[model samples]
Target: MKLLSTPTRRIVAISFFCMLAFQATYFVGVIGCATYTLGADAAGVSALVFLLNVVLVAGNLASGPLIDSAGPRRTLLAVCAATSVLGLAVWLAPVSYPGLVAAAMALGFSFGMSTTAIDAYPRYFSEDAGELARMNSLNQVATGASVVVGPALAGWVTTWAPVQCVFAILALAPLPAVALVWATREELTAARGEGAGCGAGAPGAGGEAPTQDAVPGLFVEGDATPAPDGRAGVRGFLSDAAEGVRLVFGRSELRVLFFIGFLGFFVYGAFDSLESLFYRDVLRVGADWMGWLSAASGVGVVVGSLLVLRIPKQRLSTRLLAAILALVGVGSMIYTGTPIVAVAAVGQVICGIGFGALAPVRTTLTQQRCEPGNVGRVSSVMRMGMNSAGTLPLLVSPALAAAFGPQAVLFGASTLAALIGLAFALRGDE
Candidate 1:
């Protein structure tokens, strides 16, 4: 089919390869170290997560606007190239704390920047909601594949290779991304956008302007508006950011999403940060077993993302979200209470599914509720929910777990998570 010959196919393929390089090298080399071993103080893990959040927020907040200006392909390619370079730098860098922090920020910032950039790419490629969902789902699936592979490969580096060698390997993942960018150079050009993307300004559409539809996190300039610098004006950025903020307070959907993002981060942040530790310390499982658990969690993400498409949009309810999350909590509670890795794998899968369902649903709704002109800004604002909570809670949960106990902290955290889910379920979006 000509579709196979088209830019969409290439974009999806290259984008996925880029993710594989990123996820593996990233989780294995840095994130693994950043997370505290059960042998270490639990607070170490929390602090690592906190650092990740701070770096991600700082980088993404600034970069998100840039993506809005540069367009997705350019932004995505730039981030990938930067990451590949940074990974090498990490490999060669000194081992002191300052060096680590600097290198970590470079790696982290590149990864975070890439995420925001690539995420917005689909907006420039797809033509309708179905296409958008398909792209998102495909990207999610790619992400799942990376999650499964990243640790297993990296585990080898973490074990056999000098820990520093891990960065060398991490540096390689971006190679394909770079090559793909080059080979497909023309595809990412005006021709790649030959077909319509989401709306209004889609490149073709028989010379008619892009349809005036709203897409969160993808704010376009004024209709037929092209700035000389190719960036949104300061006024537009601030105004759009402001609109999303106002919506967060005034819109039922946005409010629910923000809270849900917080709860997810607060509860799941600590839990995920401790996954390796749970196996080693709590269950006495080995690295292979730990890797399997992580893989299983990846499956959860794929399954959940796939399931989101089938979900009836009209029936969306906070109560239902609560129930789903409550069940996820149950799975976690069972694992912790029983100290079973198998059981925890099940919980991870459920949580993954929940994440998939919640993320797309929340994003779609948030996009739908925002003003057509301010999609990108609003999306970024709404995103702050998960980002803030996900990163911040890492600081607290690990410390709390260390001070108290993993079992106690997990149990309490599970309760709080289920409570948030239930509150949303009962209260709905409002």
Candidate 2:
């Protein structure tokens, strides 16, 4: 697609491979492996999840400045390399409690960095709002592809092969992605400079000056002055990141979306963190089927993203987000309430579809509303909110499950999430 230049396309492809590896490693290689090795009791799982999220939250906070200062190529390379090493560490390290926790933290940081870099990297290449949406949607497709397959592959491999072998495979998965990203370093860095002049120097087609909000790419008229030429220093990163947070909270729409996004991802993190255990203990499903169920959601997400193309263009508003949130809520209830695997799978697909549509819309809306200079920071901040929100659930869900039963805990959380979405949906767009 014209929305993506060759280098950007390469970046997206690398993102896909990296996501595939990550999904595979995380779901099966890390979580599943840990469950098998450590036993899937609530306390152990909860502690592991809490540790991972703590590190992940830290990574999310730092990723924005790191990307801005270090550049995406360098960030990608560092994240990918670190991830591969961690995967190996998880494999080779003694599987004692401390050893597993240490491995989880390292993996969490790498994964956190990877997500921020991927989300921010594409902004440099998109020329307009439409192109940005298309790029993000396509990126969703790549991620969805991984979501569809990663679990199934991981489950199968871990089930059949030695659990350690899954991590070994994951260790090698990112080498190619690292190599591909390295090849594009010059182009990627050059785009960073090219991005500086995006809205600042270019008039819209037909020689009309772009409006403060109308121009595409990162910097629009009246936006924060574009970053200085060449690499950003530590002080510049802090300034840019702080400005980004201010911009996000300063806007009503951005603020609202971040709030809703946080709720959505909180439910997601809780659900995912407990899903394997729930299915194992409550539903009697095995690892392979667990993977398949996840793939069902992946399919739904891909379909939902594609479906967005058919929706007519209009200004994004709270109404649209509310509706999608409501849809997700309903789906969550179905998935969490059901004991039947098939029924739960159906629910998973429904939730996935809602999220699939919501992801691109939210991302594009954020981009459109953001001043170019603040794009990376704003995006990172919202993401950080979601990631941070998940931390509480990671720490507390196991305790809740222990007291109330996992099924009750999940159902209650899903119900709250659904109500939150529905309530927001009922509220008229501001």
Candidate 3:
């Protein structure tokens, strides 16, 4: 059955594998060590997550130019291979402090690069906004599905088999992504030289010749001029990165989106970091109920993503984003307002759906606004904002919760989200 198109199948399969691998590694790293008494604890756990966040931010910064220079497919394949190798290493190495730290570094860098590259891969298939939205929604669905299943699967494997076996299985998940990406090498080559196909003077996929005006990024999109010496050295890389940062800040629209993304990830990171505490201490949820509570958001993500297909394509606008943001804020507030476990669960579901719907819309807008040539770089910048926002919050969330209480911190996060969403809604496109 040809229910899915070739490109769609490839993108979905790769996205699924990446999400599954990421979730498995993350949960295993956090929960596996403690559940099995392998040495890492609540304190040590923070170190691992902190290491991952640091590497993720660095990777996002480096990945933008790398994707533009190396092309998205190649970058995707490389990251997948690296992730698989790291997963295996995590399993094979002695579960010691040093070993786990090394695994964290490798895994974090690989996962970071994987995410940055995957967002750009869809461009190889379609440039249309609707098509991109649908594709992004599918990718979000993959992530939601994996989030629902990955932890459960990891727990089951850790219970029945040894932790090593669980790691080994997670390692294999990226192998399929590697193969799928390698198969599309030809497509990647074509996409890399997209300008050539438009002929000498025809417009690019962005609907006009890429110009230096209205854009100032690490790499100029339509410059036919080849790189000096055919390679950007370390200095060049840094310079390009600086320019990309400038471009993002110079544009008002990009700046607003970046701020919203930061707030989104900041809230998510804070909530996720305090999730176990809230459920265990406040709601008194058991391990079984905890899993269900966690999966509720994932279920909502799937349900909300499906709604994208039904929405009138033209109606997906800045206003849609505002609505989604407000919904997420409201959901989070409701979730944190009560000590009742069931009510919190409902809040999680609502928040998940809102975030899920926003994912595709945000991606579409980012892709639409940025020139095709620099989409990867712009996306990486966006990731940088989101990733960076999460890092500090994650580190502080536990301590903050201890002082202010989980409910209070969570309520503040919701208020922040609501205010940001309101700004976007009221400001309109400048």
Candidate 4:
């Protein structure tokens, strides 16, 4: 009876965790195989990974409008189903690289597409900027938890069942999504109704309804009424997408945010890609411990996310971002010198803190700066920065590590962080 009490159903929250569970397994598998499957062809897998990013960019850009038009509920449901289906395809048909490429495209589009739209959910039900940050943090926690869970699941299934069995297990991903959607159907519709309630001509006058203030995330100004109904296959997408791009670039703040995302996470990539190998080979840790090591970094993210929830959004975002640059730089540099298993954990946690804490600032700032019509397009473009930043480091990191040994790599990461932090700190209130 207590469970049946009438409370706001967090269907979107449930959907996200479920989706993340599946994604974690897939991501771990893909990354795990990058070195092995690609083998001497490791160079090629790096390129393939970058190629997958292109699809990510396209999917990200398109998802904004899709969510804008059909709303998050329908849009996410379709994407989840598509991801599950493709996960099976990737499992069942382990074909040539070209087939894998096609599968990658589908997987990237379907699975990755949910990120932006899902991030926007707080506006549908909550208005407190801090609450929105918490929602975002919840996703982060879910991501970390799944990171812990998914790889373990993949490990168990791989030994007991065929690799294909992994796909079928993954197909279970969208199951919880179904329940989440059904439970929250009414609330989502109400949000769409509100958004659509605003006439098309009104630029910033989104659905006039106020968001729920009880939650701890950011306020959503534009989840306004549903996109105009009728004719849902690619026509409106082209027109709206073109407009969305035009509008986003027109704003100046968006440009700055784009740069921040690229520079900040670009530095992150430098460290993250090479850390595991450093831990395994140099620090002399084992495979079994990799999970704990990874988890060590994830703990930082959770702490950072929770911290973000407490901080005043804009008031603290810049300062924290600046501070983290120094923390990450110094922290990572420590790892190179000590290389002790215990010390490595400390450094990883600091790096993770920087990583987790920074995500909301970059993301929230981007959304805050978006024009009503351009939220979707702008969301995609910011992701483009993230994609670029994330991709370049993988290829560049190994080279950097090779050219100047492991110590150099850590110090270089430190330098990258220090420089970025100083830049922002020097910006002085803008």
Candidate 5:
């Protein structure tokens, strides 16, 4: 049966592959660079991850206005082109630590922009809750597929070829997306027009209007005033960004969603510092195993995404979200609690399922609850919350990992996440 319309399918396909390309480059570059260029130094790897996330936070802050002003089509085209160029530069240039760091920053920013654009696409294409849920599920499928292939591909490639070649291949990956997005220009423009009138406060949109204090002067009375012109300078941009932040926190539902997402990612921060080392030190395996285990997790994510599709739309509730969060934490504990490679892979899959299921639920809730006109900005605020949460724990994770072995540190974090998820689930917060 045809689930999504032709245009929607095309858009989903483009987003899927584009995100795959970007994620592949990221995984390959980070793993290859860490293993080969940085000589497997944990501290150096931590620094790279920290810097990349810092730039990503900046990119998320800027992308909301770009999406709201220029539209997702334009934003996608620009970021994809920039990513391809950055990849080409890294491929051709000398492989110095400094060069890699610069490339990582560029990639991080482009990634942040592209992610916000992609997330906002569903809001533009349709307003139906079921359709939005389907779109988000498909998007999460793309993420899962990328997670499966990218790291595994990285691991396999690093086993034989020079790390430089991976970047060369990455240079070609986003080119297809550029062409695809350009072809959809007219469709996207029309969709954007339709979406603007479907905001929560619109006559038939079926939601209470946001409070005056939600965005102060920006959404004066019940109308969403157009943001100041894009060329209106930094003050205008900051105003737009601040509006997005306020819009998210002003609503009780959005605020709760943001907190849930933040907690999930905050728990993930430790993995940046300790995951690879877990493979080497705990699993007592080569770096290649990390890719394979990650792929296993990706497979689990695929399963989880499929499960979401089968769920009754009504069942996709906050309680389900809480359950999935707890599931993920349990999986993480299983993943890190064991020293055996086979056992770790099992844990990865279990953990992957929770993550896979979690994305669509959170995204669908955010999309459904927010005003359509401000979807892009709202999504960016959500992204910023998660990214910042993910980034902050990095500051202390390495120290924790060092003091207590990587496995123990990871285990403790997982336990904490599980406890939090369970608490929330039992409380049944709406």
Candidate 6:
């Protein structure tokens, strides 16, 4: 049998290339702009990262409702257009620190929205636990493939051209996704149908959905009160957003999953602040090595995600997720704990496996626990937690790196992550 249907394959394709564009433009472009423009100043880079995360938080908050109200396809089309426009504008404008900062904010917000839409798309396709797991793993494979290719492409571009030029090329990256999504719009939207919204007691294999009494403001399908005016519309949106938050935090299973994701991304936030510095100062490597190492990690992600595909459906669990988290932490510790470039490359591969495996597992768990009507909002809530966790440490990472050195600070962070993972593993079922 074919592993995925024709429409499902198209969805996967749209997700892959759109994320590839995002990875190249925002992930690499922001850092490259900071490094080349700011002379690799730690403070400047941290500020840029911090700004991106802040805007990302806001975007995610807004996107959940947009996706739920407007539908994921439309929301994705709008963000893809926004990304393209922002990239072209940044490319045309004379390169300056201020210009880069503005571009970062716009791009960061778009990226945040795109992330929510992409992740929530799987639920729109299937409610079956095994199918959801398979789709999520494939989606992660797309992400891993993008990670492998996007940075390497950016690294190559920087060799012969200025880093600013990467944005110009990235301007066209989302155009294909726009065309593809628009073409497949009706079929994809139709798939959402009546089953998209789940009522109370309709949880997936992971655990029970929040009861009506437990989640006071949960958005029940067919129960929405019509708004009389524009002001009511605004209030309605806020109410929906608030309901999403309550749904996530109010459920016991979701709460544990939320904190697990928060801890994982907390480690990544520190990486955002100090990882490039670690490359330049600690390993004494050229900028290209950063791209190469990221690509290595991407390879590991592919391997780990593929591994997830081979596991029996009966074996998927929160305990397994905790073990994967611990593995990721150990890989990160190895990556940062040593001075040898080869050893670090190995560590990147190991760490990448953890990240790759982590997404499918976490997403499966969240989908299993979430109501269909609130999928977009619930996904956004989880993103908000992860992004908020990521944003918080940036405020102090520069100082911590300065006082303790980047290598030492990073190693400590990794160690803490491993211990948290182990602790969660010991706690048993969600």
Superposed Cα deviation of residue 135, candidate 2 (Å)? 5.5
Model 5, position 11, has a per-residue lDDT of: 69
The 10-residue segment of model 1 with minimum total lDDT is: 186-195
lDDT (tens digit, per residue) of candidate 3 on 127-182: 56788788787886687788877666665665556655566755899998888887
Give the per-residue lDDT digits (tens) of candidate 1, residues 1-430: 4644655565666666666665555444554444322234456545555666578667777787786556656776787777777778878876444555566667667767777766666666555788778877677666677877765666565555555566776578887776655544432234323323534455444445543333332334433455556455766767777877886777766677677766765666767566556656677754445445666667777787788678787766555555666665655566565577667777777776776566666667666667778677667776676666666656676667677777777767777777767766777555
- Cα lDDT of candidate 1 equals 0.63
Q: What is model 3's C-alpha RMSD?
A: 7.1
lDDT of 6 at 39: 66
**Residue-pair clashes, model 1:** 13
Best by TM-score: 2
Computed on alpha carbons, the lDDT of every model, listed in order, comes to: 0.63, 0.75, 0.71, 0.60, 0.76, 0.79
Kindly report which residue stretches of model 1 are placed more than 4 angstroms away from their true locations once superposed: 1-5, 34-40, 61-78, 89-99, 120-137, 155-168, 186-243, 251-254, 272-276, 286-290, 365-381, 426-430
Model 2, residue 352: C-alpha shift (Å)? 0.7
lDDT-wise, the better of 1 and 4 is 1
TM-score of 3: 0.68
Candidate 5 lDDT score at position 334? 91
Backbone clash numbers for all candidates listed: 13, 2, 0, 13, 0, 0
Instruction: Candidate 5: list runs displaced more than 4 Å.
Output: 1-9, 64-75, 119-140, 188-260, 309-320, 361-385, 423-430
Instruction: Give the per-residue lDDT digits (tens) of candidate 2, residues 82-159.
Output: 878877777776667777678778777877888888887777665667877776767766787889888777767756
- Model 6 agreement with the true structure over 113-135: per-residue lDDT tens digits: 98898777666655567877787
Candidates 1 and 5, the one with greater lDDT: 5
> Which residue ranges in model 3 land beyond 4 Å of their true spot?
1-8, 31-44, 60-82, 92-98, 116-141, 155-168, 178-258, 283-291, 308-320, 336-341, 362-384, 405-407, 419-430
Q: Which one is best on lDDT?
A: 6
User: For candidate 6, which ten residues in a row score worst on lDDT?
Assistant: 212-221
Model 1 TM-score relative to the real fold? 0.75
lDDT of candidate 5 at residue 245, scale 0 to 100:
94
Between 1 and 6, whose lDDT is larger?
6
Off by over 4 Å in 4: 1-13, 37-42, 68-70, 92-103, 120-169, 186-261, 271-290, 308-320, 334-342, 360-387, 394-411, 419-430
